[model samples]
Target: MTMTPSLPSFDLQIDRADLLEMERDVWNNASVPARLKIEDNMYDVYIRYRGSYTRALEKKSYHVEFEKPGIWNGASEVHLNAELFDPSHFRNKLSLDFIRDLGIHTPNSQHILLTRNGEPLGLYLQLESVDDTYLCKRNLPPGTIYYAVSDKANFSIKRKRGLTSGYQRKLGNMQDDHQLIHFIRSINTSPHEIPRLLNIENYLRWLAGAVCTMNNDGFTHNYALYLNSEDHLFSIIPWDYDATFGRKVNGDVMEYDYVSITGKTKNKLTTQLMKRSGYRRRYKGILEEILETKFNKNYLEDKVMDLHSSLRPYILMDPHIHSDIDSYDREPSFIFQFIEDRKAFLRRELKKL
Candidate 1:
C-alpha cells in the first residue's frame, strides 16, 4: 500500500477590519490579532506582512507571532515565506540544510499550507525565527542576535548615506549596539583583533557555505549575527536563502559562474580575511572538503530529486508560482547542471588560492 505525503495546514482567522488595516499599510510592523487553527487546536496569534518587496506582490509572505510560548514545535514566532521567487521552491530549505551540515547554525524550515479567512493561500515555507527560543532549542548559551537588514550591515564603519545602521536587533539591550559598532571598527582598522572578537572557524564555515551555495546577495545581508555572551565573539547564521542555487532573488535564472569562489569582496570582514594567507588557506580547505563531500553532482542531484518528488504534487496548487509549472518540473535538471558546473568552477578557483 502506498500512502500519499501531505503538509500540515494552518487556518488563520482575522477580523475583517484588522485585515483591511493590515492590507492598507503593508509595510507597517504592527501585527493584527488573529486566531490560527491547526487541526483541532486554535492559538491566539498576531499576523503581519513579512518581507520587503513581497508585501507588494500578488502573493504575500506573513509573520506570525503566538501570544503564548511553546506553540508549534517550541516556536513562538515563524515567518511564512511565499517563495514566489523560486520556481523549485526548494533552494531556501536546501541551502539552509547544507549550511547546517557544514556545522554552521541555520534556521529550521518546513513546508506548510496556509489559509486566511477560509481563503486558500497555497503552500508556504514556514521558517523558524531566530530568537531566545531558537538558542534554547539548540541548547546554546544566551546571546545577542541582530539581523543584517541591508548591505550596510557589512562589517564596515561607513553607513549607507541616510541609514543609521544596517542591522536590526532582535534580542538583547541597546548596549549591544556598542559591541557591534566596536566589531565593525575592528574589522576596518584592527584586522589582527578579528580572531579574538569573531569566531573565525565558524565564520569560515559560513563563508564556505555561502560560496558553495552561490548566495550572491548573502554577503552583506540576509544573515544573522550571534554575539556569545560568555566569550563576546560573534558567529554568523545564514538566512533568506531562497535566492541561492542558480537563481536570483528576483526569480531570474542566474549563471553558474555568477559568484566567484572567494564570494563577495565588498564586505570589509571578508575582504580583509581574504587578504590574509592563513584565513585564505583555511577557507580554501573548507571549500575543498565541502566539494569533495556535499557539493558534488551525485549528492546534490539526489537532494534536488527528492525535493522535487515531494513538492511536485503541491507545486501546481501554489497559485503564485504554478503559472510556470513546466519550469518548476524541469528545475531539478537545471539545478544539477548548476551543481556540476559550480563544482568544477570552485575546484579550479580553489587551486588558484
Candidate 2:
C-alpha cells in the first residue's frame, strides 16, 4: 500500500471586510494584504481571487504574491487552484507532469490544504507562476511570455474584436508585441518558415500532450507562448488543464471521443502545420511514442492508483466537493477508460494520417 503523504497547510490571516469585498466583486483583480503561516514561519503576502468562472465558486482559487522574492520554494508568486471542476483533483497535476516529462516547459504543481482566518477552506493545487522567476528557476535565458486568454488568441490577423492580438503579455514590453504579431502574420503568409520562428518539436510535443490528455480548451487558449531571447524561437507551455481527461471545465462528464485526434483546428498554427506531410508525420510519431510509453492504460494505471490513494482521504475531508465519495472513488476507472478509448482513437487516426 502506498503511504499517505502529509499534506502541508497554508493558514491565511486576512481582514473580514476585505475578504467580503473581494467576494462581493468576483471579477476584481485587486489583492488584499494578508499574513500566511506555513509550518513554523509566517510571511506577509498579497492574496487575491484567481480564475474565470471559478471566482463565483463557493471554494475559490487564489493568487498569492510574497512581499519578498524567493520566499516560498523560490517562487515570488503562486496560483492556488481550488480545482472545483475536477472531481479527482489530480487531472491538472497529471497533465502538467506528463508535459514536463516530455521535455516541454510546464509549470510545477503540488496539492496543499488551505485555511482562512483559522477556518479550513479545502485542498488546492499550488502552481508556480510562469514569470521571470519561472525562467530563473529553470536556469533558462531571459524570455518574454504571453498568455492566450481568449479564442481570439488564435494566430490570425483578423480577430473577433477587430484586434490583432488576444494575448496578455506577462513578461515583455510593447516591442515584444510587434515581434509576436509579425510571427502570427508569418504563420498565415509563410507557413514554411514556421520552423525558423517556432520550436516545432517542442510545440508538437505540447500538442501531443494536449491531445492525449483531451484538454478540449488547450488548442487556441489555455496555454502560454514563450519567446526565447537567445534562440528567437517561440515554444508553448501547458496551462489551465483541470478541464481535461473526460471532463469539461464545468464538471460535466464527456465521452472519450469528445475531442478529435487532430485536436482543435480553430488555430491557424495547427491547421497549417497539419497540412504539411512532414509536420503531420512528426506529430504522428510523437503521439505513437507517448501512447506506447506514458499515455496508455497500462502505463497510467499506477499513476492513477497512486494519486487516488494519496488524495482519497483528503478529498473525503474536503467540504466543497460537489460529488459524493462513491463518485470520487469511481473517477479512477473513468480516467483509465478514457486512456484506453483515447489511445485506440489516436491509433486509428494516426494510421489515417
Clashes (N, CA, C under 3 Å) per candidate = 0, 0
Candidate no. 2 TM-score: 0.96
TM-score of 1: 0.96
Q: Model 1 over residues 298-339: C-alpha lDDT tens digits?
A: 777777777888887788887666678898888888888888
lDDT of 2 by residue, 1-353 (tens): 65799898889899889888887898999999888888778888999998988888889999999984346888888999999778888999988987887889899999998888888888899998889989998998999999898888888767455334678999989888887887898998988889999999998999899998999899989888999999999999889999888999988987778877778878789999999999999998988899898898777788888888888888878888734678889899999888898888888888888
Q: Which runs of model 1 end up more than 4 angstroms from their true locations? A: 159-164
Which regions in candidate 2 have their CA more than 4 angstroms from the true location? Answer: 160-164
lDDT of each: 0.88, 0.87
What TM-score against the true fold does each predicted structure earn? Answer: 0.96, 0.96
